[model samples]
Target: VSGNYAYVADYANGLVITDVTDPRNPQEVGHIDTAGHANGVYVSGNHAYIADWLNGLVIVDISDPSSPEKIGHFDTDGGTRGIYVSGDYAYVADTSNGLVIIDVSNPNSPEERGHIDTIYACGVYVSGNYAYIADERNGLVIADVSNPSSPEEVGHIDMGDKAWETFVSEGYAYVADQTNGLVIVDISDSENPEEVGHIDTYSALGVYVSGNYAYVANHVEGLAIIDVSNPSSPGEESYIDTDDLAQGVYVSEGYAYIADQTNGLVIVNVSNPSSPEEVGQIDTGDKACGVYVSGNYAYVADTSNGLVIIDVSNPNSPEERGHIDTIYACGVYVSGNYAYVADLGNGLVIIDVSDPSSPEEIGHFDTDGYAQEVYVSGNYAYIADWLNGLVIVDVSDPRDPKLAGHIDTDGWAHGVYVSGDYAYVADWLNGLVIVDVSDPNNPKLAYDMLWMTFYSVFGM
Candidate 1:
């Protein structure tokens, strides 16, 4: 509004002008009708270029701000949605015909100079004579709209394949891309996340990073360990085969703990990673789906028998010390004096494990659907409820655990890992979903800023 006047492109009213010299209490003093809907406008000197959808560019002279005069017009190949004026020409973003350059040097007769065909040209801005196009489906595309007639592609940003399960460690993030396998992304610069490495595996369900290695749970293939010391190129050292389905994994001390559905807790001596052999095993009465090791006890979520606690202090001969019965227990997370069990049918079951010999139920939070996986952080217990999605329970009052919040995910929320203020969820068919849980009572899901706190990756 350098000319003390502002020209607005209105869909209903072709063009509307308002005097801003008075700053406040200024009213619309000029109006003009175009053949088509006025979508966008750009003012330069005394000329106001309007991108009239369907009708192309409609040039108006605002020399006299009170009453605008339509001096020139140009019909484009397709509907124009956005426009930018520079020098003697006006660049219009023609919906499907790409960038259409209209010469407005002669106010009386504006003609189309040239055009570059682009798909779904929704938005465009000219800077340094180059046009930045907001291409739908495709990431930001910078084209040399400088030469509108022969606009050449100057640069482009590539958005890598989508990831479902993500594990962030140190400066890198291990992502599980079902079809593409494991993708290593460099998140040192959160502003610009780039894929540095990737490994092809068959259906990576869960991912965990420990020391210089990355542990990936490969459904049928078992545990696939990769040397991630070099973030750019992760080399697969070896793979350990298990009896049944390997759904989740956790690396602690020098051993790799695997949750083998039918085999219960499968402990592999990862000290010698290249050729890992099963050193110890313990059955949980039923299908053991999830496991967590804290101190001398190994908490197992046995789908049929519920929470099974085993003494892993003796790595060679691990024996069951205690057990807590629950309905269809699928996941277990061991915390101080308590064991959080994700009961698929019942909901979140809290058990008191002050004594390793006997465990008793302390509290419970009845959820909506199948609670498949559980993770404990602070006074809150996050449960991945299969159909109902994420269910957050406040466990500060163990005897009376209350529902803190709940978020319905796009897909079946089978697994979750809480880190910082966001929950990195492994949504079954919906890929990786980052939910903002800074406010436990009111959780949000959208990309913004990230703040660190504790380092915890509890896999499904």
Candidate 2:
């Protein structure tokens, strides 16, 4: 008996559901056809929402594990890509048209509420009464959405190049400014936002803020840690350089796990920020992209090799615990005893790691596009996709994972992270995106913006 399930939005294949209840025997469950190309999905209560490329938004009912039916949908002026739901509003990344807002008070009928047109909007997030938007070349934008129907832009930060992702904590926002690396901003005063500090991690992509540190997933630089004790003057404290190109990073216990492109899994001891050192490493012989650490084990997305597990009891000497080779693997995260692996082309793979030494493939799910990164919070797994944007999955039952909801931001999404009731994503070329996922199923774009800037003081 396996204990894993998955929901995938298989672009041309529609949305594919699989039962990984057994790692070696993943079986298909259900899928819903869409109007156009599929990009992402989200689930709320018993309904699943999808970002259907040109088709706009598609809603589906998934109360019954065996059957999924289309409920309602709406099309946007721009292409639909990433999405987030909060209260009764759905936020969509409408590509060049910027952020689109919709009303979903009635799951079967959605209505357009408002929209904020800006550069290349990619991801959106809502916190308190403000919304954060990732505006690619334009940088980070803060908007006052107390009036959801008429969102008003309040503050803006121009990050050079493209701002890929953004995460907010306390009073600061952490932004991934593509080639510029990680940028820290003080959003305490949304009207007059200021850049406090930044770490030039080369080509950084994703960012997550934990405690007093900001963890950046640098493409070829691995994981870079910066101290954020002073939101206005954050400084690089230490870094763990993996042998391969790195994409995503997650911190748990006292260690930092990295998804190393060619090196596979890399674990580091961050107990001492100034003296960060690689404690363990494993080569999966594949392009490892994202990673998450839990307890004494680390889970890695071994691109073509699927999911690779490694024991980190002895950080200095890690051993391969188990693996379930699948299609193109991208992102990975662990919750409790199960590990969720994002399979770019295949979808999502769930594995039981109760016995790290002998992991078991339990469930699987397909998505609408190329799965990029995944973040598990509460009972849902938020996925970032290249074409689909953001998809939500229900993991209440590890053995029977199901599509919960979805929203589309018209852009190429690369990574995702959940904080409080909002989910932040890294949108390649576009910028950092913020989405409201408090409702789990229906996500609405709350904010979007570019995450970097360049300035020259004439007097200085």
Candidate 3:
């Protein structure tokens, strides 16, 4: 919200600009439907920057509230969640790319100046020369943004629970800690910020500090006002119940590792699926696209961070051991000593994970289309190439993978799984496409299930 016009990110509806000059009754002035899911928005000068969830940063010209126009955009290639515009730059809390600093000096051509990867950057607030990131699970991460080209993490504090949003005022940082409520931190010393006070609230996601009161937005409990006159003993002033605006569940050995998009990697104890409990989790510092558990290690295909290897030997405390950067790793398949990754732009990347601590990309096969999913069977690897359809690669020799066969499907191929002699491909709009891989050299389309909508095709 800026001045008399309120810029709202209305999800699928895009950005909605309303005139709130009359606090009693606001009127919808103008709106622009964005290409992606509009999650967070920030208004600066005559422009309003929107953090469009998959499509990246969208810049809109709000010079005229009656007819807001989109001038330019910058694709962060990740799920952009929160945004904060200051000076000539716009800071974005990108789920997969972390805190992205964009030079919005030219609203018509916003350029990415720099970025720093965090666990799950849900929200961000820039104060002075530091950028405070509300990193879920990883807690609050403070980075020195004086130099946007290469921001550095100078201080960090684990909020115990998920840190969703933060508002800094004076010398204190008030954080909305999910499940744990409002936590106040003393930031007089940026190098070593300490938690000075806290008040529990149910699923707190947003917060705003003004004068002596802090307004908090909670998930289950709605909006709660707290008196922060004394930072040490803050008390809840009043509350009003309101309907608040609000992924992959991978289960292995009584433990479920979820590649939660904006929430990062969440591990739950699903020993009893009926009544599961969250044990521990680690933010992959990017979008946790896919996870493959091989023995004690969990290989996560973090979209922007590539393949992130986590030591899940202890489900209560999963830790990221190593990571190998890739263009955009969305899916991963581990077989024996190797981890095969289906990198979107870079195609297939074969990494040697014999050493979990230091995985190295030994070979790669650039496919004709965008690779989204992969399945390894015996000496062959089946990849779901978006437009180019199903691509078959011979992994008989992991070090030097060769393309064996490829068959274009009716629609976009999103996922693939091989079983017996057939490779099941999940074609986006065209439904299921079964390809006969009995002959790896000359693959044939066995059948096409032209009905159900699918994203991933897997065989049991």
Candidate 4:
């Protein structure tokens, strides 16, 4: 929040600038649809730095609040969760890549200065000569960033709990420790920061310190206000009660197989699309990211669990048949007897699923960008490779699939579906992008339907 405008990194809508001069009646002034999912935002001077998930850091010119424009971007190796802009550099808490410091002196061309790989850096707070990282399960990690080009970890605290975000103020660091709630630490000594106090709250995910109060954004609970006037012992001043956020669904036969994230794979009788009813469910033990239904079997791209095959011969009682773990399965497409998976960072992975009880990896093709979703057509596979856009691969020879062609879309490609000679891509905020795939080796943008409201498009 700066002056009378509030810059929000709205996940679904991108960067939203609101007129908050009237707190009781805040009004949205303008917004810009970013190429990727906006997870966090930091407004500095005339620009707004956005931590865009897979697309990395996106810099927007907000000098005109009502008409924000994308000025620059720097793609990171890992998912960008939070961003903090200080001086001429932007510090990013890149999930897998850890703390990535980018020289954003030139907003139009930001460059990576350096990075420190930690367990899982999610959020970061840079103050004076130190940077505090909320390293998820790794806890609070303190780094000496007196030199942006080569920041080094000076100290760390392992709570064996998930740290989502951090707020540093007056020599003290407040952490939003998910299940562990809010934890206070003394950062006066950068080399030996110690936990000074803590208070359990319902799923604390964000924290902000103002004067003697600490505001926590909790998942299950609403806004929790803690009185941190005394760093050694904090007390809950007040609390209010909150709400929640589907990956993929495949309709076949008379049922629909849904990769329902934490809920796992859900089988719904969708013979009547208008009035679908839940029929069965099976816990995939991990995030159910995508699903492909073929014949009487259901193939699930169970994120961390990899590819999971379920015997859905009876929609009423689906059971696990066999499974093969891949790098990071997120999307699956079954063609003939092969199960093609869009394995996040690992790209395309083809598995022989001729025998449902014993699946075998047969081939794979490493893509240039993050693989999110895939659609198989004829002897070719069209992949929605995040920032790299629509990547076309020839799977004519299942033993060794090769890249055919690709077209960089206007936005991040998250999902794709092929029909006839055109491939419909769910290009995040850019909406539905239609690609001409008449020739597998030479794909082109047929049309970009940017007005449509779609996240993941599918063709029947």
Candidate 5:
């Protein structure tokens, strides 16, 4: 509420407009529906800009308080959670979508202006039009995305994570700690992420958070669901047993897609998270180690089989749609029709999935070190190059993907997640290492938190 009227973006409901003439009694004056869940709102002279999670931005005209109406909307490829309006643009703290800018000169027709692709943007605060992003492992990052088309980072809060896997959601990061079970950190102070909670779960390999629930892919015990509403005290709400070993997990819609190593891809109905029931299963003919779901398809990193695509549109009955060959495909990231595969032996293998029935390798960049995980943002594809640290490749030219930059980490880089201008590396023995990738051409090491100090000083 910046002026006469107070604008509210409801998470469950839509946008709620209220008349706050008098502080004691704020009465609802007008309202409108927004796609997905409305997570954050910003008020301009007479317009209410809403940051609709997954659905993107929705502009509502409130010039006539009693009759607020939607004027325009722009869909974002990544998840949007927070927003801020300044001058003639709106800055959005979009997860994976990074920082998105919208030109709102015409209140009735807001259009996409510019964006900075990031893998883990916590939250965004704006002053003088410049956006301040709370970036997890990288800390606080100051960016001038005012010129939408060419956004750049001016400053950053550097720190580091022997973090196994990392996931960013609504200003917080959940990590599967092999040594600590589960670790939750608050990235609101982008420059200062503090450990907010932890839980023990024997041994954890991967983790995913949906709503208030954090799903832990336990190596030997299966899957563990934790209630994270109270970040300071995360409580285990339930646990479900799975076949073989659960190495990775991806939650989408109402199902938990698990990369059940050796056993292959396993699907469980999580609509009722506590009691997860196996609804579907796909034996990829190889060890399933990584999984990612998009639309109605499930792309799997079948260790020996290379890339295996499955049709999970029918959750209870998943069928193999296609398969492509690559060398030790361990991690994957799909964007549009291209599937970027982290081939340990061959390097970055780009497969054109325009036809899911037959994915073809269009291009590849043979990289150094053991490629573990990958995250694609904009034209760049980031790889956690084992001992090589962070490897940034220019993928703008899909078929001609080339190495744009590379940064060596302190430890063996096992996993990597990018948000905006920084890359959070899960450096196995070194812990979590944060690198500034704003200047992709010259990736510089910001800082790293070494849990195993002995390994930090000595080569492992």
Candidate 6:
């Protein structure tokens, strides 16, 4: 809880509000019923946006945290899931319909701006004047959305397997390519995106790039580090074998924190890029899937155990500080003093990690599908769902998360990452997926790369 307001979308329960002036204690303020299942939420000033599954979009005025009133809505022809907001437009991931852009200048009356049909449209982000869409099997799609009402497809690149999510930075796009591992693309030219390099982890699900290193969460291979100093020729630098299946990874300082399936939380020292070593580890009993590090502590998604906090002041000896037992935790990311956990079947769980030794669950967002991975940037949390694809939620109000926008990539989304204005995803068998999340609400696909073969003759 950062300020005086908070919003949450409680799947079948609807949207809920709370006052979080006191980080330790959060009080529920209001609630609003939705026609369909609520999955994601976003709060902008006095308005709260929601991604209502079968019902499409739902808008509400949250000026009065205790009494939110519905203002307007727009129903997409297909299943409404993920969403993002930028400028005066809202980007939506409508199941099989690809990407849908809407004019939200009039909060109460959102009008369809434009759309690009693709495979499974999951998550989106807007950067500059372009939209990046995570198109599951199809890969990353970059669209020129200077004119929201007439968005145009500009470029695309498909990674071998299903692309669950993506993150773009410094003219490069890092993607989570399910079984194909992590892929890096050169998006310097949005209209002619190309695959500069890639690191295959066999079954990697999520990825994050910080500085010259890229951290990947390999389901069974554990955490992998790749040196991307040369974008056109990126190569695997090191590997931290957690033993347990790794799902999500986050880097802070010189350490890489990983979410391990059964080994719980595993911390690696990446200061030596060539010799990345496991510094600390903890077993949560439950399946540890996602992780994020902040200050001296590390937050982990302990699957059925909810959220677990560990002290990382001594990277070689991380001690369990606190934990919150919730439904099914999957992904986790930390910002400020709060740790956001993606609770698969339970939705989103927000906890106050101000006191690492005694963390507490402050709030939650119960989306319809089973949330897989999560990425936090600015004020939003992009969630990848196995069934529904990608769902974006506003965590400005840690306790009460609101739906901003969403995209439904047709495949089974496993992981997500945000960079610049793009979101990358790792879809099971679909390959690498990219989405333009610059607009936040309305994201579009740019490019895709299905399969690339490289052969070499040994003893000719």
Predictions in order: lDDT: 0.75, 0.72, 0.76, 0.77, 0.78, 0.72
Which candidate leads the pack in TM-score? 5
Could you give me the TM-score of model 1 versus the true structure? 0.60
How would you order the candidates by lDDT, starting with the best? 5, 4, 3, 1, 6, 2
Which RMSD does model 4 reach against the true structure?
A: 22.0
TM-score of each: 0.60, 0.60, 0.49, 0.51, 0.63, 0.58
Compose the digit string of candidate 4's lDDT tens values, residues 311-385: 999888889999998878878889999999999867899999999899999998989677987889899999988
lDDT of 5 by residue, 1-460 (tens): 5555677888768888887666446799887888679998878788888889988888888889788888888788777888878888888888876888888888667777888866676567665535766555454566876577778887664433224677777777788865567877775555556778988886777888899898888877888889999989999988888888988889999899999988889898988977788888888888888888889899999876899999998998999999997768898888899999888746788999889999999999877666788889889998887756778999999889888998877456777777767777777555567678989989887666543211110000
Quote the lDDT for 21 in model 2.
67
**Candidate 1 Cα deviation (angstroms), residue 440:** 0.6
Tens digits of per-residue lDDT for model 2, 343-451: 7766777888888867887887777677776778889988886657788999888778899988776546767777776766666534555678879878888765443
Per-residue lDDT of candidate 6, residues 328-359 (tens digit): 77767777888777777667778888888788
Supply the global lDDT for candidate 4: 0.77
Query: What's the count of clashing pairs in each model shown?
Result: 2, 74, 0, 0, 12, 86
Model 1 segments more than 4 A misplaced: 1-165, 176-179, 186-195, 448-460
lDDT of 1: 0.75
Task: Report the CA-based lDDT of candidate 2 relative to the real structure.
Answer: 0.72
- Show where candidate 5 strays beyond 4 Å: 1-163, 452-460
lDDT score of residue 9 within candidate 6: 76
Q: Give the TM-score comparing model 5 with the true structure, all chains together.
A: 0.63
TM-score of 6: 0.58
lDDT of 5 at 256: 94
> Model 6, residue 392: displacement in angstroms?
3.1
